[model samples]
Target: MKKILISGMAAFILSLAVPCAVYAEEYMDGRTENGTALSVQAMAVTEDIHRVVDVLKTGRMDEGSAGDASFWQLGAGTFSMSRNIMEAAQAQAPAGARLSSYTQDDLYILAHVICGEAQSYPDDEQLYVGSVVLNRVSHPSFPDSVSAVVFQRGQYACTWDGNYYREPTPQNWANARYLLEHGSVLPGNVVWQSGGRQGSGVYIRTRYHCYCY
Candidate 1:
């Protein structure tokens, strides 16, 4: 454990230091036999690249994988340094604990919770709801199984309000199966959600809930 922590910290620190190139240029100058002056050209290639990077960073980049990080330093001010560090950490990270251990019962439980929470929403949002449950099952802070995360007391209101017992729609079942097969449309760390923004960890929002880490 100590070795792993040290390695991770070392990797994180080293990766964070991978600076974004703010400036670059190539110039070649040679005098002709007559020593005539040649045309001067300045492309400002670095500046153009910097400008493009600035714009691209503000938009989404594989947000489904992004959800697990709780928050990303997306401010253009930080630039690619943070992006590289995140990639490093994810590369070494362990798979969600016991996520592959889920059974048929867990699938039904997931479908029921989706039915209770997001059945009326679009098909994707319904899958997002199911994804939240699976993300929790794999996260270190929560229980490690679908049924455990869904019924883990006060975590999901539907489990208590009798809504979870409803027969799930066909779409809900499909969403549940898709989650177990293809994984979340959300990130792996987004376990908390509410009607409005809840915390500093905000990731995305749907019609009925704000999902966050």
Candidate 2:
């Protein structure tokens, strides 16, 4: 999804157009993750269209929609219908997995931090690292947002290790998304711990990572 700049005049004209009718092209029709292409046999596309129409007519936006807010930001207050269309498109997407209320920047920052800190750990442990970051965000003690929590001084080694700037792998992305959507399997009370020492109370320990209150 590359960003494109639209001029005011063009945006004004587009705002007048009915979104669903104007942008009904087939999308995400590519091969699946398993490398199986869409069925060559002609399939009725009616059900999908009906879902889109229902979503649009109802004017209800679900949990998350791959940065739909940014798409409508250009027209701002002028394009309510257009926003519905985008939302509908998002709803109809094959992978309609709902995400936590975090924005794209939040997700990216989390993935980077998690990758930097626990890249060598197994998937669940990696998720634990991410859960720690998210936990801090939600907790009353730490900073409110992902960026704030991550950049807070003397907290994470990766922040100073130069690894925070490195690119995250695809698996890192998957792990991060899973954590964000489903949250930590560990108890919410279990918030802080380092790799080494077990603190006073009972701790959540798994593989190489250990978490405590």
Candidate 3:
């Protein structure tokens, strides 16, 4: 729903004063390649909020929300939409569903990092790259967003050595999407990976790297 920003949903995280008592069901159903049915009809008052929620659940949007102002309204609705959708995006890992927490840009950033750091590695290892990134996002010591963690100073060689700039292949996108949708396969505490850098603990080891907490 990138069209959401263009549709007038600006950054209101810090400025928003409205109290949003958003409640969402964490369980998703109607197993399909798309997504589950949301009981979000209660919140779909605005045309844009309805549209955005439908896209998240059904995997279809008339236009990219990023470039269209009609996709979502600005201000209070933005906070409501984002907050509720984030709660809606969460899923049990074994459910194997899309989290929808990462936006298009967020997915692109994640896919790029996965490709950059573990392209040549085996499937499990490549997937591990994404798990590690997600781990860092939830960790106390790292930034809270995917882009921030991937681009943080001295955190990854790929970001500074030009590897991060390479075009991510479809497989890279698949891996990133898989991790986000299905929840990370790695443990939440397993936040560190690869060589040189140190971690508090080790959890798994593949052909190319050690996954650590």
C-alpha lDDT (0 to 100) for residue 58 of candidate 3: 69
Instruction: List the global CA lDDT of all models.
Output: 0.59, 0.58, 0.62
RMSD of each: 19.6, 19.0, 17.2
The best candidate by lDDT is 3
lDDT of each residue in 1-213, candidate 2, tens digit only: 122233343345344423332332322133242111211111212233333344445644344554355334424533443454445544543331223586888889989988898776688788778877877777778888889989999988889989988889888888887877777655454557577644343344555766764
The residue pairs found clashing in candidate 1 are: 67-187, 68-187, 68-188, 68-189
Candidate 2 segments exceeding 4 Å error: 1-100, 198-202
Could you give me the TM-score of model 1 versus the true structure?
A: 0.54
Question: How are the candidates ranked when ordered by TM-score, highest leading?
Answer: 1, 3, 2
The candidate that wins on TM-score is 1
Rate residue 31 of model 2 by lDDT: 27
**Alpha-carbon deviation at 128 in model 3, angstroms:** 0.5
lDDT of 3 at 179: 87
> Candidate 1, residues 69-177: lDDT per residue as tens digits?
3223332323344444344334432333225556799888989999988877789789778877888877778887788889898888898888888888898998888
TM-scores for all candidates: the values are 0.54, 0.50, 0.52
| Count of clashes, each model | 4, 0, 12
